[model samples]
Target: MKNKLPLYLLLFFLIIVNAFFLYNYLGAGDQGGPKDQIRPGDFLVKELGLDATQQAAFRTLGREHHRKMRGLLDDIKELKDALFKGLSDDPSHQVNVDSIVHLIGEKEAAKDLEVFRHFKKVQALCNAKQKEKFAKIIEDGLRVGGRDQGPRGARPEGERGPRSKGFEDNRPPRPNGPNANRPPPAARE
Candidate 1:
């Protein structure tokens, strides 16, 4: 009976542990999970306060844009694959790398145009106040570091980030006084 008591207690403890694991794994998702993540389109719709008709139109536009972008991206991938495949082919085989690269660039340009057209259509659905807000949103998105810094997330105007080793200015420091541009004495000799 003493040995049985330990076995029963062990079984009970195991059951409690399993229950806690199951509760955390299955229950945490209901509170905050992937399902709660805000998609870009949903963010736009919510931000713009799109009405039922506007939301429907926006969704349709989004679907069409996604379909077109997918096709363009697939085409770009194929071109890139061909470009890399050329590297493995016989040396004598002709592979016009430039043409393949140009095609990829064209496809990318088409994607940009498609996105521009999609946004324009979306703008057509907005009221005046919403349009202003939309413009501000687009401007914010286009800004470097998204409204905080300069191009490529560079430090603001006067401030500089730490310089990486080996990339430091290789040129000799400029002479600060009267002989700044004068050649060195050895060079003059």
Candidate 2:
């Protein structure tokens, strides 16, 4: 009984600690923080330690990326609309359903590529330290819903939470996208 008491107390403590993390992970996680407002310009200016003049130039780059990517999003939305409109009560609609799914997959892939490019742009602006901070922001961002900071199933990379905005994976960071040849440095890394 004495030995059992120690084991039971350890189990109780483990449960308490886990529950605390679970609560924070669920209720007050990523979405409750400033990361929600973090844009490419924010990372370029703050994380990379850029000057005010450089910050202005970086903002232009962010605006351009946003503009180009948003156009792609419009096309993706059109695909979604087509998929929904294809749904008919006819039992022979399987072929249309399959096609819609395939089109959605293509749109999703393109979106993911764009996200990868954005990451590359941001990384080009960073030296080493800023990259670490960018990685932390990404990991934290992935914790938006719950403890699962990864794909639960075999969903497409972009189909996950971050893709709707950006970022395909939330890990130790990868060399996503083609690195920018040269971005005029606003400040030191």
Candidate 3:
């Protein structure tokens, strides 16, 4: 009877602990933040605190900007495909690579200018308070997306250091001394 009593108490304690853990696990589990069905325009409308009139303007601007940007983006993708296709073929086929790169740059620049103009239109709809909030929101977005940074591998203005001539992939530094290009003794032997 004594042994049975101890076993029953142990079982009860285990059950209580298990229940506590199970309750906590279920309670602390993530509830997905927002509905998955929210569209970007919906997010912008809500986050930007747009009124009915502003929302209409925003939707119009977004639609036009998306259409223009989509065409430019498609052009850029086509140019990239051409560039890579040439690269994959004989090196001689890459003679037009420079032109393709230039076209891509032009398209990208146009896309950027279009986005800037679209945002300006959006900003025009904002009141003073909303404008201030909008600026902060834009700043936060640039910071988050790292769009404010210079091009990759480009030094910031006023900073002058020797630019790397080419990519170095885990290679030993090139020796500049008299023995730089001499064959090793083992190779000579």
lDDT of each: 0.83, 0.70, 0.80
Per-model TM against the reference: 0.63, 0.50, 0.57
Model 2 lDDT tens row, 70-155: 98789878888877786665768888878878887887888789878877776666658777877887777668737684445534
Q: Give the best candidate by TM-score.
A: 1
How far out, in Å, is residue 120 in model 2? Answer: 1.2
lDDT for model 2 comes to: 0.70
The residue-by-residue lDDT of candidate 3 on 31-92, one tens digit each, is: 63564778867876888799999888888888998999999999999999988878667677
Q: How does candidate 1 score on lDDT?
A: 0.83
Badly placed stretches (over 4 Å) of model 3 are: 1-37, 147-189
Residue 134, candidate 2: alpha-carbon lDDT: 74
Lowest lDDT block of 10, candidate 3: 156-165
Sort order, TM-score high to low:
1, 3, 2
Q: How big is the positional error of residue 184 in model 3, measured in Å on the Cα after superposition?
A: 38
